[model samples]
Target: LPWHTTGKLSTNRVTSSCSRRAMPELLQFKDASSMRKYSRLQRQAGKRIALVPTMGYLHAGHMSLVQAATDRADIVIASIYVNPTQFSRNEDFGVYPKAREEDHRKLLAAGCAAVFEPASLYHPGTVSSDGAGDNANVVGAGEHVVGAHETFIQVEQLQKGLCGVSRPHFFRGVATIVAKLFNIVEPDVAVFGKKDYQQWRVICRMVRDLDFDVEVVGVATGREEDGMAMSSRNALLTPDNRQRAVCISQALKWAEEQISHREATPSGIQHEVTDRISTGGGRVDYVSVTDAENLQELKHFVSGQEVLVAVAAFFGSVRLIDNVVSVKQAG
Candidate 1:
């Protein structure tokens, strides 16, 4: 296959034609069975495998995850499937953006061992009206596709708050699809972004409780020059909305400052963040301060308890989420 040379190397990193040899060949897989076959072969040969799950439309944030996988395993498999189960009906699932060509280029440039672009995995039967057609030969990644499968994985209590408040069914979709990926890929390790802090904790809990042998790694969130966490949805932001979106990170920074200064209580910090984001011309979804480990809602600041201050808001049509977590210590 043709490799992508268009991706620019980040500052402090050297790029040259010879460096490409250090990167593995970018193989493409369109179904679980084929990808699993390769995984089985790798396991038999005593090679370690690392998996990075993602919806297509790769960015620098995704490349960071891929890089983490490469550092840990002999082979890196990145799955690009836009799971319909994770998106609510009113959410923008249909138009979430699928740049397979560009994503392929980026993955190739990032030295991914294989790209699993399954049509649909969980939905096995004919396609449902959710846009997945009935003609799919095998089970693939398609929304609204009819399938006999009804089993879903959920991390009780954890999914009840935070981003889950607005999108109730979102985590169910995420947990179920992720379980499926872990089963099919059977990776020795998996990497996820901490931008979705709650989701990361949820996956970590699920892995531990389910007894999956795979190691779950949380890579730090990747941000743009302006401090906005990079996401596929960033493309949906209009020019002015994009500028206004910077307030999300700004509010986070302000909350961090308040924590450092010991000037604001948990609720006060939450209200201040809500006000700042709202005053910045964005609609607030939820501004919360909770225990980072258990996500229990915090009433007042408690020393030694790790607290997570997370925010989700709408900048125009785009819903943005960011968080800051730290151990509360006595000043």
Candidate 2:
């Protein structure tokens, strides 16, 4: 639990001396049009709004983004939609962890003003008026619902490689939903975690190329005390695999040290990392270094060049990813 507050309590607005301070009202909206109307009102009133888009099952990493939002804006709206498009047919879309009640509590505790939770933004037909299913799509005029949304935004160049190699449809889903959120929220700023480094870069480029008048800020990745990158999937790791999973981050740290203090070849470093995680009982997906900005694979390290050493592996059915970004400084 990342329960943290930055500013002091307002002395002017007092409810009771013994009573604890009240949490912000957590408004929930299932319609994008309603959310847009609320946001429009906020903007008209001279209030600056910050948007933190997320799939539910909130964690410290997500909370950190909300904290960043509150730090910058007058009000913060957190969108919690488990995007179905981002998950392929074989992926864990159906089984992905969800904690609606707990997530609501956490967001309210974290000072989030409201939560935008539509049943299906892409495919509106998946959800019914009774609210019994998984989908939440936005219906258009004539009450005719789109069965499955095909029109989507794509960040062409940035989505070519890296995680894109494995999860082909991931970035397309991400960009499309995020663009929708930006339009609906009409936020002045949006905060994204850098743990998904490629996703963050792709979104930054999308905003620039598409002319969305929203400033996208990439916040540093939040980590656990043990150094493993915090993710929703961590809970699925078996006890033994959970302990061994530390090797993913350890490999990145080891590679960073070798690059910084000793002469290191990209291939040599990758081989060692692959061996380290493999011997630890993890099935390697990819262990490679690439140019940070373009995500082009690197052959060797050069001074003044920035690179990201990223790794993804599976321990059982759960897949994990971690990375260490290094810049070889120029003299």
Candidate 3:
């Protein structure tokens, strides 16, 4: 297995080299059985495993996650699968960017011990279709297919509001797939990015509530030099749209500043964020200020309690999300 170095990742706090040891040859697995077998073997050998689950099209943000995993575990395994259950029929799952070979090279350089590239984690033998196939199981709207993946995990209260409000099926797909990954990988630790703030909280809640034996680690959101959050979907942004996408981060920062200065209501901050993003040539999907831990939508800021200011907007057809956590101080 020849691993090519593709230069250093441009993510915040992430370097190309693994802190623990030299890069090892990356093992690739395409099916669940083989990946599970390997994980079992690693455990038998007394090696602690860490899992970083991702969709293909690796970027600096993903590399940051890999770096986090490498630091904590003896072996790091990154799973790349574009889950169909997460996206709605109107969403852009069909056009999601993918660079399998490039992703492998990047993960290898980032010190991932292996890459799990399962074609269909849910459907076993059949390939996942592009017609929102997971929706049938997620919402129970259509006739059940014989042997189709029917089981789904939902974090109920935590899945409400934020991205979950708009993309109703999104968290269901995320929680389910991540649970599947936890079982299959059986790693000592699992790493996730906080850029998807709600998703991170949802997974945390799922793990705690279900009592899974894996430690879930949430890494800080990796940003570009311009402060735009890194995401695979950024590949879909045209140059002009990409530039305008900065408003998402800008709005989040502004909200943080406002909350830190004085008492502010969630509605006022949401209005301002919505305005900023809309004026910056983007369509506002949602802007929410909620309790950081429970994700309950807050009416007013309280002293010393952290609140998450999150926004999702569309730059052209690409939807980008960003968030900032702020704690108000008592005057």
Best by TM-score: 3
Which wins on lDDT, candidate 2 or candidate 3? 3
Candidate 2 lDDT by residue in tens digits, 1-331: 1112223211111112232575335777777777887777778888889999998888999999999999999889899888876776666676778898888778877878778888777644643535524332221112334463558889998897878888888899899999999988899999998888889989999999999999898887788888899888888888999999988888888998887777888899999999999988899988878888888888988897887888889998898887888876543
- lDDT tens digits by residue: candidate 3, 1-331: 1323222211111233453564346777777877887788788888999999998899999999999998999889999988888987678877889998788779888888788887677763254434644344434345556667778999999998999878999999999999999998999999999999899999999999999998999999999999999999999999999999998888888999988887678899999999999999999999888999999898887799898999899998899999999888784
Model 1 lowest lDDT segment of ten: 5-14
RMSD of each predicted structure: 6.3, 6.6, 6.3
Candidate 1 TM-score versus the reference: 0.88
lDDT of 3 at 83: 86
Q: How well does model 2 score by local distance difference test? A: 0.80
Model 2 error, position 87 (Å): 0.8
Which candidate number has the best lDDT? 3
All candidates: TM-score = 0.88, 0.86, 0.88
Alpha-carbon error at 86 in model 3, in Å? Answer: 0.5
Off by over 4 Å in 3: 1-23, 124-143
| Tens digit of per-residue lDDT, candidate 1, span 150-257 | 788999989999999988888887898899999888999999999988899989989999999999999988999999988899999999999999999999988887
In model 3, state the lDDT of residue 78: 94
lDDT of each candidate versus the true structure: 0.81, 0.80, 0.84
Q: Give candidate 1 misplaced runs (Cα > 4 Å).
A: 1-24, 124-131, 134-147
Once model 2 is optimally superposed onto the true structure by TM-score, how far is the C-alpha of residue 149 displaced, in angstroms? Answer: 1.5
Which whole-number lDDT from 0 to 100 does residue 28 have in model 1?
72
